[model samples]
Target chain A: MLDHNAAAARIFTAALIVIGDEILSGRTHDKNIAQVATWLQVQGIRLKEVRVVADEEPAIVEAVNTLRARNDYLFTTGGIGPTHDDITVDAIAAALGVGVEVHPAARAILEDYYATRGGLTEARLRMARVPAGADLIPNRFTGAPGIRWGNIYIMAGVPSITAGMLEALTGTLEGGAPLLSETIGCWVGESEVADLLRQTEKTHEGCQIGSYPFWREGRTGANFVIRSVDPDRLAACCAALAAGLTAGGRTPVAGGL
Target chain B: MLDHNAAAARIFTAALIVIGDEILSGRTHDKNIAQVATWLQVQGIRLKEVRVVADEEPAIVEAVNTLRARNDYLFTTGGIGPTHDDITVDAIAAALGVGVEVHPAARAILEDYYATRGGLTEARLRMARVPAGADLIPNRFTGAPGIRWGNIYIMAGVPSITAGMLEALTGTLEGGAPLLSETIGCWVGESEVADLLRQTEKTHEGCQIGSYPFWREGRTGANFVIRSVDPDRLAACCAALAAGLTAGGRTPVAGGL
Candidate 1:
């Protein structure tokens, strides 16, 4: 089990499994990881790792097993379609030792969804496939629903569907309070004040310190982003950092992260 | 062993390690994974996984070991600066069971890099420190340089630097032919043709099919992208797919993946 004793700062690690042959072939530029990573951070969750794998059964099964065993929450996007390549549902079902078929509730959603246009046929009815003992996640856009099995929440490959499901699912699930970040960006080359920067980092015990160097117009400088669960602590660390850099002769302006 | 010997098709996997705390704080949106994935893919290399970790020794060391063991190649970004968070060199050395300090060639790169800038202090000279027995990767942007350790290539976290390092390293590595992809954007919803799509997938053994449903301007449709290492096979699969969808009364458009 992961260490969850500390309420002060418990890192919420997430593993993003981007399942699609399109991504592997460079057909689809994955927008899920970046957007999800940003969202997780806002929710005080740390996105530890991300995986992009082909729409193959063995590959998906192996990736899910590996990532699920390691992280706290596993959010998977893609392969939950009605087409031939949409095998994520089956793979996930097999991985959990569950049977996959059309669940009544999920079928109800698809049946209602298809009735308006074309009555549910074999091609369209495939959207109702759900693993045993799983709950259906309503799709506000289309009638075909998604399922939530164990800790794995499967969403549509399209960004809209994925985001819609996450909005609902994320609300129902518990999450740590959001993390706040502070950054100081100014013109001080890393090489010019390497000694003082090292000292400031040593002084700050728990806060995370990162130096980002940028070249704009010709001047070079590093941006120090200090992040912590506590906003007060972050501000305090930044103050000390600015004072430290100033006392060492360089003028630093701060804001970011 | 990863058991790649008898694979029916050429499959390659990679993991990205971002050794900086700025990412966790949302200060810098990482672009390395997307760019590198695109590059590796052009040469038929698959990027499987990625990890954005802090500069903490234990975290970096643990991540390097786990990722390297799972994938064929591991590309690391950030944490090779002249500052204190620049402990990637030492942490990697510790993970590899080797002692680390300033290797001569790495030190030379730093010396030359500093000579153009003006002077190299002991602090600035810290950028030269690299793990022992690492082959140096030439840095076209700045001279502090990156190193290649076994299958793992340690690179700059900065977007431009990492990209430059990747280009120089690409020609030096052995890779397979490029992967080809094809996409068919259909004006029909996924739920309308999911079942037939599954059957089409079951029939085609040589190609991978992915259907992505998108909503634009009150119209909802699915974009199906098929992928494979073989170009002729991919074209053949898409051809059959067009016929199958047409038979189902849904018109599928043809395009690039």
Candidate 2:
């Protein structure tokens, strides 16, 4: 079992398992990684790692057991629909050493939803099947609820539905202080400011600076993102970086280029 | 050691490690995952898994060692630049029990490329560092060349730069038959045709069918993606699916909606 109640000042981390073959085959561009990462940050939790796996039972089971064991929480998106490829619930159940069972509330919700559209079919009821002893995360968009078994959150592969599940999950999990960031963009090559960045990050004990270089308008530029759990330290690090860029005769853009 | 001389008819798989704090922070939506996935598909190499980790040494080292050991090929993008956060070279070296060294050829290439553009400062020279006993993957976008050691390919984080490196290394690696896919769109909910999809896929032998549901124009619809390595099997599966959709009183779109 994970020691979730370790210390108040400890960092809270979550890992995501993206279950789908479409993503691996390059048929779909995944928006859930960024969506979940951003949402976790706002909830004061850090998204430490993400694994994109194919829609296979062993693959999903391995990823679920591996990530859920290491992180504070595990969130999965995809493979929960009514199709044959939708096997996340079953895979996760096997990983947790549990049997698959239909959640009463979820079945009732699907029945009510399909009452007017069409009578509930066995295929539609597949959406209600969850790992034994699992709760439901309400979905406002579709009647199919997301599954919540232990720390594992099984969300929909669709971006909009995932967004609704995230909205419903806001402020529900315990987390540390939110990681704050300040981005400073400059129309200068990153190599020109690498030393300054290293120095600034070293000066701020709790801060980290990331340099992302890009070529735009036929000129080399980069956006340096400084992050820290402390707001005062984040601000100081950003100011130092801005000063360094100015000292090097480059005007820094506030947000990004 | 991984057996590179596997049976010719066997599937060749590769894993990708995307190392960056920007991606984990949700500040940057990753483009390299799709780019590499598409490129690897064209090369007839199936992408088995992808792990996105932060710009930390232990994280990079763990991902590198784990993925490199399991897959036929392991590729990494990001943290290969001149910034302080760029620690891919050192971390990979640590993982392989190798030492970091400045490759003379890489140094010469950087000297030539940076002669007119700022004359190769110390910070820019950092790009020349590589894991010892590693070959270079040519980069036409910038002076910094990608690294190739054993079956691991260390690529640039920038999508364009990574594309250039991938283009340079094209046709150099051996792989099996490329995976083929066909998409059929229908204006019907996936649950309505789930049984047909499951039966069709089971009957098709090697084909796997994925159903992606969407809502547009205030109407429910779905796109069924059928994939197989054998062209005949893929075509047969798509034809069967289209026929089934038509039999169920739905028009199937050939290339998806």
Candidate 3:
């Protein structure tokens, strides 16, 4: 059990960079962050950090260089389309000190997909451009395949297309045990149970407790989320928390409110 | 108009740091990024970048130090509650090379607010703690006030509470002209109009056009958003793009698809 816990501590982490002007301008609400985070969790890869940057080259390059160097994998969404504003591939190539080139597989895919809609124009061909020495992640939804350079992935800005790309890459990356979680909700203010929550977390090894308070139906309540890499540990911690809340004269909802 | 454009080019920029393990764990979807970005836009401050980091002290401290040094304002959300995981105050204090102290006004406010519900426990008093020499941003919804220290605003993690803090801060910061934008939607693939969009943007002196493509109702379409500090320039850019789209045999929707 101890060795297993120790081995599980080698967590694989990923960072996400969302590249677009619309998000920073507040014109579009970004769904990619949550989408990528949730998908990474299922793959047992912890999303360590996320950066939402503009469509500028320097910003994208800096983010790409900084995050990719530190994490196991770096994923970027947006700015891969066929517009003048789509500068992600170029910026990433610059960050890697490599030149950009049109990938043959990507070009073939786009050409065949666009044969009926419209012959691939120069603008549409931009989607085939990728960093030098890069592979392709198949985009089942969109004709333009996503770009994969070493540990970095350049995916579509559109949520549905990005989802498709992620689905294709599932189980391909090596990661540790999937982090498990259990949520317990109580109709009481968080401050009233802060001590109990802290002590419960302290008593439970390899577990973390997060308190999220809310006001709904004109009453104060909180949801305590307990997380662990071990399902048994997570369940034990959750049960302990529920027992504490019950002793404090509050009913604990097993799955949260 | 040239002088005015030059003056408007001096853009006030802000960076946001969203601190939470829940967001990173995919347990919660972040709404604060869009909320802060929209509010900053109305205040004429450009949201240059956003970093969503974990609740760990080192991550928060590093993000706070890095962003605060580069941008005009640095705002952080999350980890301000009355629990062990709520370590934002300590982290920010560490980042600023200052000590954490309970603010008198904040303590008073919490005490008064919690008087009828329950006496202010040590856990609740955690909300009163802030970086030394920081001012309070009044939270009308809850007793726990937000903190502000030298260009850094520490807001609540909850959407509604953060909204109240932003409402209190509206029109308080000095900023330049608010960026104006006009959106035109058309039932045409972005690749088909990529050249026209690029040329229209080049023709406009102080405007940028962002093309967002989507598929709806079994048809491909796009929305081109034209943004500029000068409203007239924005309007002209929108009109030129609209005319270009129309000339390409597509009807342009004024408000977007």
Every model's TM-score: 0.87, 0.96, 0.98
- Give the better candidate number (1 or 2) by TM-score: 2
Chain B TM-score list for all models: 0.89, 0.96, 0.97
Evaluate residue A232 in candidate 3 and report its C-alpha lDDT on the 0 to 100 scale: 87
Candidate 1 chain B worst ten-residue window by lDDT = B1-10
The CAPRI class of candidate 2 is high
Best by TM-score: 3
Model 3 iRMS (Å) reads 0.7
| CA displacement after TM-score superposition, residue B111 of candidate 3 (Å) | 0.9
Write model 1 residue lDDT over A123-232, tens digit each, in one string.
66667887788888878977667678777777777777777777766656555645666778767777777777677767776676767887677777778777677777
True contacts kept of 2: 0.82
lDDT of 2 by residue, A1-257 (tens): 23543443589999999999999989899999999999999988999999999988999999999999999999999999998889999999999999999999999999999999888999999999999999999998889999999998999999999999999999999898788998899999999888999999999999999899999889999998889988888998889889889998999999988
Tell me how each candidate scores on DockQ against the true complex: 0.44, 0.82, 0.84
lDDT of each: 0.75, 0.93, 0.93
Candidate 1 per-residue lDDT over residues B18-116, each given as its tens digit = 777666545567677677878888756777666667677887888799889987888899988787778888899898888777768877777887786
- Please give, for residues B167-215, the per-residue lDDT of candidate 2 as tens digits: 9999999888788888999999999999999999999999999999999
Error of 2 at B43 (Å): 0.6
Report residue B10 deviation for candidate 1 (angstroms). Answer: 5.4
Ranking under TM-score, best-scoring first? 3, 2, 1
* Worst window of 10 by summed lDDT in candidate 3 chain A: A2-11
* Stretches > 4 Å off in candidate 1: A1-12, B1-13, B24-26, B54-59, B66-72, B193-205, B243-252
